[model samples]
Target: MRYKGTKAGAIVVAAVTGSVVLAGCGDGSGSQVEGGGASPSASRSADAQEQGTTEVRAAYEKTAEAESARMTIKMNLAAAGKRITSDGEGVLDLATGDSVMTITAQDKTIEQRVVDQVLYQKVPGQNAPSGKPWIKIDLEKVAGQQGLSNQQIGDPAQTAAYAKAITDKDVTKVGTENVGGVSTTHYKVSVDVSKLPGGEQMSQQLGPTLPMQVWLDDEGRLRRQQIDLTVKAPASASAKPEGSASAQQLKMSTVMQFSDFGTEVNAEAPPADQVADMTDKALQGSRQQS
Candidate 1:
């Protein structure tokens, strides 16, 4: 039980701090600017392409400028023939980079809090040698080591950074749709992962291009976004050979929805006495358990 808890804690930190971000290709169903005869209809398609590029860029800017918001997230991950689903709701203070979230998975609930750019995760009290209920991680130090900017660490959805992946030629206006009871414009774009901020490491695992869908409300703010990706599971010596029929695949899907913009969010850190830092001593213990 101790080993399992420690390993799980390590996995959570790696998953969040790593550069393996959202990726995969979206189905683009819009005009082609290449190999076109100079027809009047083709000219209109070019104009529409320009319009899509503008709209997506505008949405990115608007979302970045938001003060705060209430958000819900759903994530499904499948690997090694096992599937797990998790749901979370949170309030984010964009201005202060503070937030609180509660996530539930497999009948277990975990609470996460971020205040002043530091992250705290509630864990089983027995897992901590000091009997603390919360594990503290210095997000600023970790983000710096990972070469992530302050904005990247604060933006849980990475919505702004993801929008930077799409090029003008890759965006296609898919039409209008209702999201969360609000009318929104749907757009599909194949993300060039190489263009994403801090994307150098992720592009290798997720491939160079991936698909993403975004919905923008009337004010050009991001109402919802989704990413789906399937990647080959890393092979082990005892497991089936790579690319063989028995090889495994990992499929991950994530969706984030935003509402109640400019809401006040309070995300205070746990008291010092009840917090244990994820330091060298804890890491050494985890290594031994593995």
Candidate 2:
């Protein structure tokens, strides 16, 4: 087993942390479809690609404006005799910086909420004590703990953050399809970890392949996303050999779906009586690390 709250809490952790990323296109396909240059068909393809890029941005742009949505996610990762599969449903609202999500992994449930920046968590063992069922976290301090100056804290502004994450990515149309009861266009992009903001954190945990795809509705709102990657596994936890890549690779795929735009996703803090302070225990490290 990896550790408590590590594999068990992956769904929610990945959901909130990875919700806002994807990418772009190239001439291989776009140009292939164009057939030849200096022709109306090529120009039409260029215009289509341009439109596709605009539509992709518009989808997230609309999301930033809408600020709230009901979403679901499913993820699976397996490598070196270990596998983790999980699913979750939740509300996303960046306007007020609030969110509520319930993730189920390994037959366990983990629920989390963020209201006005503070995080409330209820998980097995770590939190959800008999009387004090919620663990309250100071998000700013949590950011400091992770060495982040401005961490992504699920709010209306987060969509913009997502947009910024893929700003430099290359997006290409893979055709249209039905998604979440809506007509949507599919886009695909492959990227290097060095290109994304804070994406370097992924380098250590992942293999060389990172491909992401998304579906956007006619209204320019994202309805679905699928990310495929591989996780790197270290051979030894305590020591590192001179120069070596991960000893193993875990194939991973995550799918996220969005719906209920402009709906009410009220993410309120738990009552004070049922809460325990986690700044020192969970977010902040022990005295020395602090």
Best by TM-score: 1
- Please give the CA lDDT of all the candidate structures: 0.60, 0.57
Off by over 4 Å in 1: 1-41, 79-81, 123-129, 138-164, 197-200, 229-251, 279-290
lDDT per residue as tens, model 1, 1-290: 44334333333333322221232111122232222223244778877766666566556446546767887877777655557777878987655556788877666787878677666777443446667887776665543433344434444355445545655666778999998999999888676767776566546445777767778899877788776766443232224555576554546676778899887798898889888887444444333422
TM-score of every model? Answer: 0.70, 0.68
TM-score result, candidate 2: 0.68
How far does residue 268 in candidate 1 sit from its true spot (Å)?
Answer: 1.9
User: Distance from true position, residue 63, model 1, in Å?
Assistant: 1.9
TM-score of 1: 0.70
Candidate 1: residue 30 lDDT (0-100)? 26
- Among the numbered candidates, top lDDT falls to 1
- Residue-wise lDDT of candidate 2 within 23-139, one digit each (tens)? 222211221221111223566776676566556645555555666788887878665456778887898773564778887877888788767767677865654444576777666
